[model samples]
Target: MQRFDGRVALVTAAAQGIGAAVARRIAAEGGSVIVTDLQEDKVAELAAELGDRALAVRVDVTSRADLDAAVAAGVERFGRLDLLVNNAGACVVTAMPEDTTAEEWHRQLDLTLVSAAQSIQAALPHLLKTRGNVVTISSVNGLAAFGNLEYSAAKAGQLAMTQNFAARFGSSGVRFNVVAPGTIRTPNWDNQPDALDRLAKLYPLGRVGEPEDIAAAVAFLGSDDAAWITGHTLPVEGGVLTGPSALDLTPKGPFRKEQ
Candidate 1:
């Protein structure tokens, strides 16, 4: 039998990029998938392409109503919910910590942190009913500080939430875990030359990661193979976090310490 033959999955941000890849993979493994995004048209198109195995729903993850509705639609269509992938997120390229505007900060947090919270909250009942699992798409920035303050802060919040939720639901047979992807190549990478190069060099593998790479990790975590895993933050970073240090990349010098 296929690995996910009778499962139902709901993936956010499924119109494109990593979320889309994950949705496709789950469906390919025989799961019924609800592919949701704020971009209704693109999601609808992707859902259509996936045929009877997929359903498309328009959802703004930040909105509780939208998230609840999406979950309801999933249950109504698929008859049960077995997995929820909270993959919708956003980032802000700010000049400095102080320069980060309130609006930008809120937007980053709302999209990256609160959005996942809302989705998980809305899906909890159904997840509990099915003893389902949650696979959240966090970032390496959550574990270590990246220069993008807002993005890092929000992702950190997401990681914390993942752990807390896992602890809360673990006894009930619900599993929660995070897959933190480093420097993945997606449609969002266009026009960021400096970032792209820096990220590539940071990884021990010496190249940026691909969306499918992250998707594969998420798929594994959502499947029965990872049944014993929960509340863990797995880094799918191509050794970026474990690679050579900043000092190694710089010229050797007896650097002076500030008094």
Candidate 2:
């Protein structure tokens, strides 16, 4: 449980939900975590809850300056960087794929994909120094037709990016992997309370996932236990990816109304 003792991690989007859970898990296991998010107050509250081992940084992942400052701050405080949890992505584009505009697509990619790459670049030097690893929070949507075209595409990009980074840095003792999750009961679902109830029926596990479920997988991937693993995507879905389900992803399902 204390596998991360003496290690340090930098987690993006650590203000709430899965990001917050991962930050809590890492800190609980004796890892010093740099918890960064655009929500300054939220991350600061989380850091306070996590105690002295946690540092709150308001990092706009889209900005290289913010990413660089966060990485620098973590290193300067924790003394070294051992893990980079790329958990900042989101499904910002609600429009149907065909009707989605170029600007929206760019914005989606900027938030969900490009920012991840920028964070890696900002942390690579420190990761290289510590022989550390990265655990990117992708989505099962990336592996299947879960709708949210822009989001899924961006999530899939994280997988490919991790693979390439793994292959490029494995020899240097740096690892990269992804955890693709199914629908979770995050604040994003607060308004769509019924949607999760309906979606759970489609999953073989008969329920949805929790942020802790993802944090557990992230802990494994970012820890020494998964030292031999690299360039892979681990689906932490509630067996939803096993086969077809009753979940309707068609434009007429719910997206058209939201659009």
All candidates' lDDT scores?
A: 0.90, 0.92
- Model 2: per-residue lDDT, tens digit, 1-259? 4989999999999999999999999999999999999999999999999999999999999999999999999999989999999999888856777889999999999999999999999999999999999999999988988888999899989989999999999999999999999989899999876999888888877888999999999999999899899998999998888864545543453453343
TM-score of 1: 0.91
Q: Which stretches of candidate 1 lie over 4 Å from their true place?
A: 193-198, 245-259
Residue 77, model 2, lDDT: 95
Query: Each prediction's TM-score against the native?
Result: 0.91, 0.93
Q: What is the lDDT of residue 209 in candidate 2?
A: 95
**lDDT digits (tens) for residues 1-259 of candidate 1:** 7778999999999989899999988988899999999999999999998999899999988899999999999899989999999999988676689888899899999999999999999999999999999999999989887778899999999889999999998999999999999888888878775787786866778788888998889889999999999999999998878854354577576887689
Count of backbone clashes, every candidate in sequence: 0, 0
Q: After superposition, how far is residue 219 of candidate 1 from its true place, in Å?
A: 1.0
